[model samples]
Target: MKYLLFLSCLVISITNLYPASAHKVEVSGDVGGTLHIEPNDNPRAGEPSQAWFALTRRGGRVIPLSQCNCELAVYAQPYAAGEPPLLEPQLEPVSAERYKGIPGAEVVFPKPGIYELQLNGKPVSGARFKPFEFKFEVTVAGGSTQNSRNLRDVNGDLVEGESQKLPTWAIALPILGFIGILVVVLQNMRRSGE
Candidate 1:
Protein backbone atom coordinates (compact mmCIF):
# COMPACT_ATOMS: atom_id res chain seq x y z
CA MET A 1 0.00 0.00 0.00
CA LYS A 2 2.80 2.43 0.86
CA TYR A 3 4.61 1.55 -2.37
CA LEU A 4 1.49 2.15 -4.43
CA LEU A 5 0.90 5.55 -2.81
CA PHE A 6 4.46 6.66 -3.49
CA LEU A 7 4.22 5.55 -7.13
CA SER A 8 1.00 7.53 -7.63
CA CYS A 9 2.57 10.66 -6.13
CA LEU A 10 5.59 10.27 -8.38
CA VAL A 11 3.44 9.90 -11.49
CA ILE A 12 1.42 13.03 -10.73
CA SER A 13 4.50 15.11 -9.97
CA ILE A 14 6.27 13.96 -13.14
CA THR A 15 3.27 14.81 -15.28
CA ASN A 16 3.39 18.45 -14.08
CA LEU A 17 7.11 19.04 -14.65
CA TYR A 18 6.82 20.23 -18.23
CA PRO A 19 4.87 23.41 -18.77
CA ALA A 20 1.99 23.83 -21.19
CA SER A 21 2.06 25.94 -24.34
CA ALA A 22 1.73 29.71 -24.00
CA HIS A 23 -1.69 31.27 -24.31
CA LYS A 24 -2.74 33.32 -27.35
CA VAL A 25 -5.17 36.18 -27.53
CA GLU A 26 -8.52 35.65 -29.22
CA VAL A 27 -11.03 38.24 -30.37
CA SER A 28 -14.45 38.03 -31.92
CA GLY A 29 -14.78 39.64 -35.34
CA ASP A 30 -17.57 42.00 -36.11
CA VAL A 31 -18.64 40.21 -39.27
CA GLY A 32 -19.19 36.63 -38.08
CA GLY A 33 -16.21 34.76 -36.76
CA THR A 34 -13.46 34.54 -34.17
CA LEU A 35 -9.93 35.77 -34.81
CA HIS A 36 -7.03 34.10 -33.06
CA ILE A 37 -3.63 35.77 -32.93
CA GLU A 38 -0.48 34.20 -31.54
CA PRO A 39 2.74 36.14 -31.49
CA ASN A 40 5.86 34.17 -32.33
CA ASP A 41 7.47 35.98 -29.43
CA ASN A 42 6.72 38.84 -27.10
CA PRO A 43 6.78 42.16 -28.98
CA ARG A 44 9.89 44.21 -28.28
CA ALA A 45 10.70 47.75 -29.26
CA GLY A 46 12.57 48.10 -32.56
CA GLU A 47 12.69 44.31 -33.00
CA PRO A 48 10.76 42.50 -35.70
CA SER A 49 8.07 40.18 -34.36
CA GLN A 50 6.02 37.70 -36.33
CA ALA A 51 2.51 36.58 -35.45
CA TRP A 52 0.01 34.07 -36.81
CA PHE A 53 -3.67 34.69 -37.35
CA ALA A 54 -6.53 32.32 -37.93
CA LEU A 55 -10.14 33.04 -38.77
CA THR A 56 -12.91 30.67 -37.83
CA ARG A 57 -16.66 30.86 -38.19
CA ARG A 58 -19.06 30.87 -35.26
CA GLY A 59 -19.77 27.24 -36.08
CA GLY A 60 -16.02 26.38 -35.91
CA ARG A 61 -15.39 26.31 -39.68
CA VAL A 62 -12.12 27.84 -40.79
CA ILE A 63 -12.16 30.53 -43.43
CA PRO A 64 -9.84 29.87 -46.35
CA LEU A 65 -7.22 32.48 -47.13
CA SER A 66 -7.95 32.42 -50.84
CA GLN A 67 -11.49 33.48 -50.17
CA CYS A 68 -10.50 36.63 -48.27
CA ASN A 69 -8.29 39.66 -48.83
CA CYS A 70 -6.82 40.57 -45.43
CA GLU A 71 -4.36 43.14 -44.12
CA LEU A 72 -2.88 44.13 -40.75
CA ALA A 73 -2.27 47.69 -39.60
CA VAL A 74 -0.10 48.56 -36.60
CA TYR A 75 -0.14 51.80 -34.66
CA ALA A 76 2.06 52.86 -31.77
CA GLN A 77 0.48 54.76 -28.89
CA PRO A 78 1.94 58.24 -28.62
CA TYR A 79 4.04 58.94 -25.57
CA ALA A 80 3.32 62.61 -24.92
CA ALA A 81 -0.05 62.76 -26.65
CA GLY A 82 0.11 63.22 -30.41
CA GLU A 83 -1.34 60.94 -33.04
CA PRO A 84 0.03 57.41 -33.20
CA PRO A 85 2.30 56.22 -36.00
CA LEU A 86 0.57 53.96 -38.47
CA LEU A 87 2.38 51.09 -40.17
CA GLU A 88 1.28 48.47 -42.64
CA PRO A 89 2.36 44.94 -41.69
CA GLN A 90 3.10 42.47 -44.45
CA LEU A 91 1.32 39.14 -44.07
CA GLU A 92 1.30 36.00 -46.17
CA PRO A 93 -1.04 33.07 -46.32
CA VAL A 94 0.31 29.89 -44.72
CA SER A 95 -2.71 27.73 -45.44
CA ALA A 96 -6.43 27.76 -46.04
CA GLU A 97 -7.16 29.24 -42.59
CA ARG A 98 -3.79 30.48 -41.39
CA TYR A 99 -1.67 33.53 -42.14
CA LYS A 100 1.75 34.53 -40.81
CA GLY A 101 3.55 37.83 -40.70
CA ILE A 102 6.38 38.00 -43.21
CA PRO A 103 9.72 37.87 -41.42
CA GLY A 104 11.46 40.89 -42.92
CA ALA A 105 8.31 42.86 -43.34
CA GLU A 106 7.01 41.98 -39.91
CA VAL A 107 5.77 44.55 -37.40
CA VAL A 108 8.25 46.17 -35.03
CA PHE A 109 7.19 48.47 -32.25
CA PRO A 110 9.07 51.76 -32.33
CA LYS A 111 9.25 51.98 -28.56
CA PRO A 112 8.14 50.31 -25.35
CA GLY A 113 4.51 51.26 -25.11
CA ILE A 114 0.96 50.27 -25.88
CA TYR A 115 0.19 49.34 -29.48
CA GLU A 116 -2.93 48.48 -31.38
CA LEU A 117 -3.30 45.99 -34.19
CA GLN A 118 -6.13 46.54 -36.61
CA LEU A 119 -7.06 43.74 -38.97
CA ASN A 120 -9.33 44.53 -41.89
CA GLY A 121 -10.37 42.74 -45.05
CA LYS A 122 -13.24 41.58 -47.18
CA PRO A 123 -14.25 38.35 -48.79
CA VAL A 124 -12.72 38.03 -52.27
CA SER A 125 -14.06 36.78 -55.57
CA GLY A 126 -17.25 34.76 -55.17
CA ALA A 127 -17.22 34.51 -51.39
CA ARG A 128 -20.46 35.53 -49.75
CA PHE A 129 -19.00 36.43 -46.33
CA LYS A 130 -19.17 40.03 -45.24
CA PRO A 131 -16.22 42.33 -44.59
CA PHE A 132 -14.51 41.70 -41.26
CA GLU A 133 -12.64 44.02 -38.93
CA PHE A 134 -10.78 43.31 -35.68
CA LYS A 135 -8.75 45.38 -33.27
CA PHE A 136 -6.47 44.13 -30.47
CA GLU A 137 -4.19 45.76 -27.96
CA VAL A 138 -0.62 44.67 -27.28
CA THR A 139 1.74 45.85 -24.56
CA VAL A 140 5.49 45.69 -25.16
CA ALA A 141 8.11 45.68 -22.43
CA GLY A 142 11.87 46.47 -21.98
CA GLY A 143 12.16 48.12 -25.38
CA SER A 144 15.58 49.73 -25.85
CA THR A 145 16.10 49.70 -22.11
CA GLN A 146 19.45 49.14 -20.43
CA ASN A 147 18.25 45.86 -18.89
CA SER A 148 16.64 44.53 -22.03
CA ARG A 149 17.32 40.90 -22.93
CA ASN A 150 17.14 39.06 -26.24
CA LEU A 151 14.27 36.86 -24.93
CA ARG A 152 15.06 33.95 -27.20
CA ASP A 153 14.97 30.26 -26.31
CA VAL A 154 17.87 27.79 -26.61
CA ASN A 155 16.78 27.02 -30.19
CA GLY A 156 17.01 30.76 -31.07
CA ASP A 157 13.26 31.01 -31.19
CA LEU A 158 11.38 33.86 -29.58
CA VAL A 159 9.56 33.18 -26.29
CA GLU A 160 7.56 35.12 -23.77
CA GLY A 161 9.34 36.25 -20.63
CA GLU A 162 6.95 34.44 -18.33
CA SER A 163 7.99 31.12 -19.87
CA GLN A 164 11.72 31.69 -19.42
CA LYS A 165 12.03 30.05 -16.00
CA LEU A 166 11.01 26.61 -14.76
CA PRO A 167 9.21 26.65 -11.44
CA THR A 168 11.46 25.43 -8.61
CA TRP A 169 8.75 23.30 -7.09
CA ALA A 170 7.97 21.73 -10.43
CA ILE A 171 11.49 20.35 -10.69
CA ALA A 172 12.28 19.63 -7.06
CA LEU A 173 8.99 17.95 -6.15
CA PRO A 174 9.08 15.60 -9.13
CA ILE A 175 12.64 14.52 -8.39
CA LEU A 176 11.93 13.99 -4.71
CA GLY A 177 8.81 12.01 -5.47
CA PHE A 178 10.65 9.75 -7.90
CA ILE A 179 13.37 9.09 -5.37
CA GLY A 180 10.81 8.23 -2.70
CA ILE A 181 9.02 5.87 -5.06
CA LEU A 182 12.25 4.06 -5.91
CA VAL A 183 13.09 3.64 -2.23
CA VAL A 184 9.63 2.35 -1.45
CA VAL A 185 9.75 -0.20 -4.28
CA LEU A 186 13.16 -1.51 -3.20
CA GLN A 187 11.99 -1.96 0.38
CA ASN A 188 8.87 -3.82 -0.72
CA MET A 189 10.86 -6.14 -2.95
CA ARG A 190 13.37 -6.94 -0.14
CA ARG A 191 10.53 -7.75 2.32
CA SER A 192 8.84 -10.02 -0.25
CA GLY A 193 12.12 -11.97 -0.73
CA GLU A 194 12.50 -12.41 3.04
Candidate 2:
Protein backbone atom coordinates (compact mmCIF):
# COMPACT_ATOMS: atom_id res chain seq x y z
CA MET A 1 0.00 0.00 0.00
CA LYS A 2 2.79 2.43 0.94
CA TYR A 3 4.65 1.48 -2.24
CA LEU A 4 1.61 2.45 -4.35
CA LEU A 5 1.49 5.91 -2.79
CA PHE A 6 5.22 6.39 -3.38
CA LEU A 7 4.94 5.31 -6.99
CA SER A 8 2.10 7.77 -7.63
CA CYS A 9 4.14 10.67 -6.22
CA LEU A 10 7.13 9.77 -8.39
CA VAL A 11 5.01 9.73 -11.54
CA ILE A 12 3.56 13.15 -10.73
CA SER A 13 7.00 14.69 -10.06
CA ILE A 14 8.48 13.53 -13.38
CA THR A 15 5.51 14.92 -15.33
CA ASN A 16 5.69 18.46 -13.87
CA LEU A 17 9.39 19.43 -14.45
CA TYR A 18 9.61 21.79 -17.46
CA PRO A 19 8.18 25.15 -18.57
CA ALA A 20 5.98 25.80 -21.63
CA SER A 21 6.58 28.23 -24.50
CA ALA A 22 4.01 30.81 -25.66
CA HIS A 23 2.19 30.62 -29.02
CA LYS A 24 3.79 32.63 -31.87
CA VAL A 25 1.91 35.02 -34.23
CA GLU A 26 2.41 34.91 -38.02
CA VAL A 27 1.79 37.77 -40.57
CA SER A 28 2.10 37.38 -44.39
CA GLY A 29 0.96 39.10 -47.68
CA ASP A 30 1.78 39.80 -51.34
CA VAL A 31 4.55 42.08 -52.80
CA GLY A 32 2.99 43.69 -55.86
CA GLY A 33 5.45 45.97 -57.73
CA THR A 34 8.91 47.33 -57.03
CA LEU A 35 9.33 46.98 -53.22
CA HIS A 36 11.42 50.12 -52.63
CA ILE A 37 13.36 50.76 -49.47
CA GLU A 38 15.28 54.05 -49.09
CA PRO A 39 18.80 54.77 -47.79
CA ASN A 40 18.83 51.21 -46.41
CA ASP A 41 21.22 52.40 -43.67
CA ASN A 42 21.22 52.56 -39.90
CA PRO A 43 18.67 55.15 -38.70
CA ARG A 44 19.83 58.52 -37.39
CA ALA A 45 17.91 61.09 -35.30
CA GLY A 46 16.53 64.37 -36.81
CA GLU A 47 16.90 63.01 -40.34
CA PRO A 48 14.21 63.39 -43.04
CA SER A 49 13.24 59.85 -44.01
CA GLN A 50 10.62 57.76 -45.92
CA ALA A 51 9.89 54.32 -47.51
CA TRP A 52 7.33 52.88 -50.06
CA PHE A 53 6.49 50.02 -52.50
CA ALA A 54 4.65 49.88 -55.85
CA LEU A 55 1.90 47.43 -56.89
CA THR A 56 1.74 45.80 -60.33
CA ARG A 57 -1.16 46.75 -62.66
CA ARG A 58 -2.58 43.26 -62.25
CA GLY A 59 -2.72 43.45 -58.39
CA GLY A 60 -4.17 47.00 -58.94
CA ARG A 61 -2.22 50.23 -59.46
CA VAL A 62 -0.95 52.49 -56.68
CA ILE A 63 -3.02 51.97 -53.50
CA PRO A 64 -5.06 55.17 -53.16
CA LEU A 65 -4.38 56.95 -49.87
CA SER A 66 -8.10 57.68 -49.35
CA GLN A 67 -9.51 54.25 -50.26
CA CYS A 68 -7.19 52.36 -47.93
CA ASN A 69 -5.98 53.99 -44.73
CA CYS A 70 -2.64 52.96 -46.26
CA GLU A 71 -0.21 52.48 -43.39
CA LEU A 72 2.94 50.38 -43.01
CA ALA A 73 4.03 48.17 -40.12
CA VAL A 74 7.13 45.97 -39.68
CA TYR A 75 8.03 42.88 -37.61
CA ALA A 76 11.25 40.90 -36.83
CA GLN A 77 11.88 37.39 -35.48
CA PRO A 78 14.40 34.55 -35.57
CA TYR A 79 14.55 32.68 -38.88
CA ALA A 80 14.40 29.05 -37.69
CA ALA A 81 11.12 29.07 -35.74
CA GLY A 82 8.17 31.23 -36.88
CA GLU A 83 7.48 33.43 -33.85
CA PRO A 84 5.89 36.82 -33.11
CA PRO A 85 8.48 39.53 -33.83
CA LEU A 86 9.03 42.89 -32.09
CA LEU A 87 7.62 46.27 -33.27
CA GLU A 88 9.18 49.76 -33.22
CA PRO A 89 7.98 53.12 -34.55
CA GLN A 90 9.17 56.73 -34.50
CA LEU A 91 5.84 58.66 -34.35
CA GLU A 92 4.07 56.48 -37.05
CA PRO A 93 6.08 56.04 -40.26
CA VAL A 94 9.59 54.64 -40.73
CA SER A 95 11.79 56.06 -43.55
CA ALA A 96 13.63 53.00 -44.74
CA GLU A 97 11.58 51.71 -47.72
CA ARG A 98 11.73 54.87 -49.93
CA TYR A 99 9.19 56.72 -47.76
CA LYS A 100 7.30 54.60 -50.22
CA GLY A 101 6.37 53.12 -46.87
CA ILE A 102 3.23 55.15 -47.38
CA PRO A 103 1.34 52.33 -49.09
CA GLY A 104 3.18 49.71 -47.10
CA ALA A 105 5.07 50.35 -43.85
CA GLU A 106 8.85 50.20 -43.39
CA VAL A 107 10.11 47.81 -40.77
CA VAL A 108 13.34 48.56 -38.89
CA PHE A 109 15.63 45.55 -38.92
CA PRO A 110 17.84 46.19 -35.90
CA LYS A 111 19.28 42.75 -35.33
CA PRO A 112 20.99 40.72 -38.06
CA GLY A 113 18.47 37.92 -38.40
CA ILE A 114 15.60 37.02 -40.77
CA TYR A 115 12.76 39.63 -40.48
CA GLU A 116 9.25 40.11 -41.95
CA LEU A 117 7.57 43.33 -43.15
CA GLN A 118 3.79 43.68 -43.57
CA LEU A 119 2.08 46.20 -45.89
CA ASN A 120 -1.26 46.74 -44.16
CA GLY A 121 -4.08 48.81 -45.65
CA LYS A 122 -7.81 49.13 -45.08
CA PRO A 123 -9.68 46.17 -46.61
CA VAL A 124 -11.23 46.80 -50.05
CA SER A 125 -13.70 44.88 -52.23
CA GLY A 126 -13.61 44.35 -56.04
CA ALA A 127 -12.34 47.46 -57.93
CA ARG A 128 -11.48 49.14 -54.62
CA PHE A 129 -8.08 48.91 -52.86
CA LYS A 130 -7.68 45.25 -51.96
CA PRO A 131 -5.71 44.43 -48.79
CA PHE A 132 -2.04 43.65 -49.52
CA GLU A 133 0.78 41.94 -47.59
CA PHE A 134 4.25 40.44 -48.10
CA LYS A 135 7.04 38.87 -45.98
CA PHE A 136 10.73 39.48 -46.60
CA GLU A 137 14.02 38.90 -44.82
CA VAL A 138 16.73 41.31 -43.59
CA THR A 139 19.91 40.90 -41.54
CA VAL A 140 21.11 43.28 -38.81
CA ALA A 141 24.28 43.63 -36.74
CA GLY A 142 24.56 41.47 -33.63
CA GLY A 143 23.04 42.72 -30.31
CA SER A 144 20.99 45.57 -31.83
CA THR A 145 18.02 45.67 -29.45
CA GLN A 146 17.42 45.19 -25.73
CA ASN A 147 15.16 42.18 -26.33
CA SER A 148 16.73 39.56 -28.61
CA ARG A 149 15.28 36.24 -29.82
CA ASN A 150 16.11 33.26 -27.58
CA LEU A 151 15.42 30.26 -29.81
CA ARG A 152 17.64 27.65 -28.22
CA ASP A 153 16.31 25.03 -25.76
CA VAL A 154 17.65 23.16 -22.71
CA ASN A 155 20.77 20.96 -22.96
CA GLY A 156 22.35 23.89 -24.80
CA ASP A 157 20.34 23.23 -27.94
CA LEU A 158 18.15 25.36 -30.21
CA VAL A 159 14.79 23.85 -29.25
CA GLU A 160 12.14 26.16 -30.72
CA GLY A 161 8.42 25.59 -30.03
CA GLU A 162 9.35 22.58 -27.93
CA SER A 163 8.08 22.76 -24.36
CA GLN A 164 7.65 20.29 -21.50
CA LYS A 165 4.14 19.21 -20.50
CA LEU A 166 2.21 19.22 -17.18
CA PRO A 167 3.29 21.13 -14.06
CA THR A 168 4.11 19.04 -10.97
CA TRP A 169 1.19 20.25 -8.85
CA ALA A 170 -1.31 19.53 -11.63
CA ILE A 171 -0.25 15.87 -11.78
CA ALA A 172 0.33 15.17 -8.11
CA LEU A 173 -3.10 15.95 -6.65
CA PRO A 174 -5.00 13.45 -8.82
CA ILE A 175 -2.67 10.57 -7.98
CA LEU A 176 -2.86 11.34 -4.25
CA GLY A 177 -6.67 11.15 -4.39
CA PHE A 178 -6.57 7.80 -6.18
CA ILE A 179 -4.24 6.29 -3.58
CA GLY A 180 -6.45 7.48 -0.72
CA ILE A 181 -9.50 5.83 -2.31
CA LEU A 182 -7.71 2.53 -2.76
CA VAL A 183 -6.51 2.45 0.86
CA VAL A 184 -10.00 3.14 2.20
CA VAL A 185 -11.51 0.30 0.07
CA LEU A 186 -8.89 -2.26 1.14
CA GLN A 187 -9.32 -1.44 4.85
CA ASN A 188 -13.07 -1.77 4.58
CA MET A 189 -12.76 -5.22 2.95
CA ARG A 190 -10.50 -6.47 5.76
CA ARG A 191 -12.87 -5.20 8.42
CA SER A 192 -15.83 -6.97 6.74
CA GLY A 193 -13.92 -10.25 6.68
CA GLU A 194 -13.26 -10.03 10.45
Candidate 3:
Protein backbone atom coordinates (compact mmCIF):
# COMPACT_ATOMS: atom_id res chain seq x y z
CA MET A 1 0.00 0.00 0.00
CA LYS A 2 2.83 2.44 0.78
CA TYR A 3 4.50 1.69 -2.55
CA LEU A 4 1.24 2.39 -4.41
CA LEU A 5 0.84 5.77 -2.70
CA PHE A 6 4.44 6.76 -3.49
CA LEU A 7 4.02 5.79 -7.15
CA SER A 8 0.88 7.89 -7.44
CA CYS A 9 2.63 10.91 -5.99
CA LEU A 10 5.51 10.54 -8.46
CA VAL A 11 3.15 10.31 -11.41
CA ILE A 12 1.29 13.43 -10.29
CA SER A 13 4.46 15.44 -10.05
CA ILE A 14 5.57 14.43 -13.54
CA THR A 15 2.17 15.14 -14.98
CA ASN A 16 2.12 18.60 -13.42
CA LEU A 17 5.35 19.52 -15.18
CA TYR A 18 4.19 18.27 -18.60
CA PRO A 19 1.18 20.48 -19.13
CA ALA A 20 -0.27 20.42 -22.67
CA SER A 21 0.88 23.95 -23.44
CA ALA A 22 4.50 23.85 -22.34
CA HIS A 23 5.87 24.81 -25.76
CA LYS A 24 7.66 28.14 -26.00
CA VAL A 25 7.87 30.35 -29.13
CA GLU A 26 10.66 32.70 -30.07
CA VAL A 27 12.11 34.66 -33.04
CA SER A 28 15.04 32.24 -32.97
CA GLY A 29 14.65 28.49 -32.68
CA ASP A 30 17.46 28.14 -30.16
CA VAL A 31 14.90 28.60 -27.40
CA GLY A 32 12.10 26.09 -26.97
CA GLY A 33 11.77 26.22 -30.79
CA THR A 34 7.99 26.41 -30.68
CA LEU A 35 7.97 28.80 -33.65
CA HIS A 36 10.73 30.60 -35.49
CA ILE A 37 9.98 33.30 -38.07
CA GLU A 38 12.79 34.64 -40.19
CA PRO A 39 12.74 38.37 -40.91
CA ASN A 40 11.50 39.12 -44.43
CA ASP A 41 10.80 35.43 -44.65
CA ASN A 42 7.19 35.99 -45.44
CA PRO A 43 6.26 33.90 -48.51
CA ARG A 44 2.70 34.94 -49.09
CA ALA A 45 1.32 38.31 -48.03
CA GLY A 46 -2.44 38.02 -48.49
CA GLU A 47 -2.31 34.30 -47.74
CA PRO A 48 -1.10 32.26 -44.80
CA SER A 49 2.60 31.54 -44.33
CA GLN A 50 4.15 28.22 -43.48
CA ALA A 51 5.39 27.58 -39.94
CA TRP A 52 7.49 24.64 -38.73
CA PHE A 53 7.95 23.29 -35.22
CA ALA A 54 9.12 20.00 -33.75
CA LEU A 55 6.34 18.57 -31.64
CA THR A 56 7.45 16.53 -28.62
CA ARG A 57 5.85 14.45 -25.93
CA ARG A 58 6.57 14.82 -22.22
CA GLY A 59 6.17 11.21 -21.12
CA GLY A 60 6.95 7.59 -21.88
CA ARG A 61 3.44 7.16 -23.26
CA VAL A 62 3.09 5.90 -26.83
CA ILE A 63 0.90 8.77 -28.07
CA PRO A 64 1.86 11.31 -30.72
CA LEU A 65 1.23 15.09 -30.60
CA SER A 66 0.17 14.85 -34.23
CA GLN A 67 -2.97 13.02 -33.24
CA CYS A 68 -4.36 16.29 -31.87
CA ASN A 69 -4.40 18.10 -35.27
CA CYS A 70 -2.92 21.30 -33.84
CA GLU A 71 -4.17 24.64 -35.06
CA LEU A 72 -2.13 27.85 -35.33
CA ALA A 73 -3.34 31.45 -35.33
CA VAL A 74 -1.43 34.68 -35.72
CA TYR A 75 -2.41 38.24 -34.75
CA ALA A 76 -0.80 41.66 -35.01
CA GLN A 77 -1.54 44.85 -33.05
CA PRO A 78 0.11 48.18 -33.79
CA TYR A 79 2.18 49.75 -31.01
CA ALA A 80 1.36 53.33 -32.01
CA ALA A 81 -1.94 55.13 -32.39
CA GLY A 82 -2.80 56.98 -35.62
CA GLU A 83 -1.19 54.05 -37.40
CA PRO A 84 -2.96 51.73 -39.76
CA PRO A 85 -5.66 49.53 -38.33
CA LEU A 86 -5.00 45.98 -37.20
CA LEU A 87 -5.14 43.18 -39.72
CA GLU A 88 -7.51 40.25 -39.69
CA PRO A 89 -6.20 37.31 -37.67
CA GLN A 90 -4.97 34.36 -39.72
CA LEU A 91 -5.71 30.69 -39.02
CA GLU A 92 -3.40 28.05 -40.46
CA PRO A 93 -3.50 24.29 -40.69
CA VAL A 94 -0.83 21.92 -39.50
CA SER A 95 0.69 19.15 -41.58
CA ALA A 96 2.24 16.14 -39.85
CA GLU A 97 3.50 16.43 -36.27
CA ARG A 98 5.69 19.26 -37.54
CA TYR A 99 3.62 22.27 -38.62
CA LYS A 100 3.62 23.75 -42.11
CA GLY A 101 0.50 25.74 -42.82
CA ILE A 102 1.28 27.28 -46.23
CA PRO A 103 4.18 26.51 -48.51
CA GLY A 104 6.87 29.21 -48.49
CA ALA A 105 5.27 30.17 -45.24
CA GLU A 106 5.87 33.44 -43.43
CA VAL A 107 4.24 35.39 -40.63
CA VAL A 108 2.85 38.59 -42.07
CA PHE A 109 2.90 41.66 -39.84
CA PRO A 110 0.47 44.10 -41.43
CA LYS A 111 2.32 46.86 -39.68
CA PRO A 112 5.15 47.22 -37.18
CA GLY A 113 3.89 46.25 -33.75
CA ILE A 114 3.67 43.53 -31.13
CA TYR A 115 2.21 40.33 -32.54
CA GLU A 116 1.14 37.08 -30.91
CA LEU A 117 1.14 33.51 -32.23
CA GLN A 118 -0.99 30.90 -30.56
CA LEU A 119 -0.81 27.11 -30.75
CA ASN A 120 -3.69 24.89 -29.72
CA GLY A 121 -3.59 21.11 -29.94
CA LYS A 122 -4.94 17.99 -28.28
CA PRO A 123 -2.71 15.12 -27.23
CA VAL A 124 -3.63 11.46 -27.04
CA SER A 125 -5.82 10.42 -24.14
CA GLY A 126 -4.19 10.35 -20.70
CA ALA A 127 -1.81 13.01 -21.99
CA ARG A 128 -2.05 16.71 -21.29
CA PHE A 129 -2.38 19.13 -24.24
CA LYS A 130 -1.84 22.67 -23.06
CA PRO A 131 -2.26 25.56 -25.49
CA PHE A 132 1.08 27.15 -26.41
CA GLU A 133 1.61 30.80 -27.33
CA PHE A 134 4.34 33.42 -27.81
CA LYS A 135 4.63 37.11 -28.69
CA PHE A 136 7.27 38.65 -30.96
CA GLU A 137 8.20 42.28 -31.51
CA VAL A 138 7.92 42.74 -35.27
CA THR A 139 9.05 46.01 -36.75
CA VAL A 140 7.80 45.90 -40.35
CA ALA A 141 10.24 46.93 -43.06
CA GLY A 142 8.65 50.24 -43.97
CA GLY A 143 7.43 53.16 -41.84
CA SER A 144 7.48 56.95 -41.92
CA THR A 145 10.30 57.10 -39.40
CA GLN A 146 13.94 56.56 -40.44
CA ASN A 147 14.48 54.70 -37.20
CA SER A 148 12.11 52.16 -38.66
CA ARG A 149 14.18 51.90 -41.81
CA ASN A 150 14.89 48.26 -42.71
CA LEU A 151 18.27 48.33 -44.44
CA ARG A 152 20.14 45.47 -46.11
CA ASP A 153 23.80 44.96 -47.03
CA VAL A 154 24.62 45.28 -50.73
CA ASN A 155 28.08 44.15 -51.86
CA GLY A 156 29.62 45.60 -48.69
CA ASP A 157 27.38 48.67 -49.09
CA LEU A 158 23.93 49.10 -47.64
CA VAL A 159 21.05 48.98 -50.10
CA GLU A 160 17.27 49.06 -49.84
CA GLY A 161 15.54 45.72 -50.20
CA GLU A 162 12.79 43.69 -48.67
CA SER A 163 15.07 41.68 -46.37
CA GLN A 164 17.52 43.21 -43.89
CA LYS A 165 17.73 46.37 -45.99
CA LEU A 166 15.97 49.68 -46.57
CA PRO A 167 12.68 49.04 -48.29
CA THR A 168 11.43 51.27 -51.07
CA TRP A 169 8.41 52.17 -48.96
CA ALA A 170 10.79 53.42 -46.31
CA ILE A 171 12.34 55.83 -48.83
CA ALA A 172 8.95 56.86 -50.16
CA LEU A 173 7.30 57.62 -46.83
CA PRO A 174 9.27 60.81 -46.01
CA ILE A 175 8.87 62.04 -49.56
CA LEU A 176 5.19 61.31 -49.55
CA GLY A 177 4.68 62.79 -46.11
CA PHE A 178 6.49 65.98 -47.15
CA ILE A 179 4.43 66.30 -50.32
CA GLY A 180 1.22 65.71 -48.41
CA ILE A 181 2.13 68.47 -45.91
CA LEU A 182 3.04 70.85 -48.72
CA VAL A 183 -0.27 70.28 -50.47
CA VAL A 184 -2.18 70.84 -47.25
CA VAL A 185 -0.28 74.05 -46.49
CA LEU A 186 -0.86 75.42 -49.98
CA GLN A 187 -4.58 74.69 -49.77
CA ASN A 188 -4.79 76.48 -46.41
CA MET A 189 -2.93 79.53 -47.78
CA ARG A 190 -5.25 79.76 -50.72
CA ARG A 191 -8.30 79.59 -48.47
CA SER A 192 -6.96 82.38 -46.20
CA GLY A 193 -6.19 84.62 -49.18
CA GLU A 194 -9.71 84.20 -50.50
**RMSD of each predicted structure:** 9.3, 16.0, 22.5
Candidate whose TM-score is highest: 1
TM-score for all models, in order of appearance: 0.50, 0.37, 0.34
Give residue 85's error in model 2 in angstroms.
Answer: 3.9
Which stretches of model 3 miss by more than 4 angstroms?
1-33, 39-49, 59-65, 78-105, 124-140, 143-194
Of the pair 1 and 2, which is ahead by TM-score? 1
- In model 1, the Cα lDDT at residue 186 comes to 88
lDDT of candidates 1 onward, in order:
0.62, 0.46, 0.44
TM-score, model 3 to reference: 0.34
The TM-score of predicted model 1 comes to 0.50
The C-alpha local distance difference test score for the whole of candidate 3 amounts to 0.44
lDDT of 1 by residue, 1-194 (tens): 76678688768758685445443445455344333333434667776665555665566556656667887777776433455547887766653234332112357777788877777768778866668777667777554433334477999886655435557886787687788778879888899989
Better of 2 and 3 by TM-score: 2
Candidate 1 regions exceeding 4 Å error are 1-41, 78-85, 95-105, 144-194
Which tens-of-lDDT digit does each residue in 1-194 have in candidate 2? 66567656766655554434221222324325344444453322223224355543345344433344444445655434554446634323323323222343444554455455555555445435446555544333443222323566567775444344567877777677666766876777689779
By summed lDDT, the worst window of 10 consecutive residues in model 3 runs over: 24-33
Task: Judge candidate 3 at residue 110 and give its lDDT.
Answer: 51
What is candidate 3's lDDT per residue for 1-194, written digit by digit as tens? 44446545654544352234233344322122344444233323333344545444344222233344455555565345454434433334445334443211245555544565555455445555454333533333333334334565656665544335456876666566656655766676679779
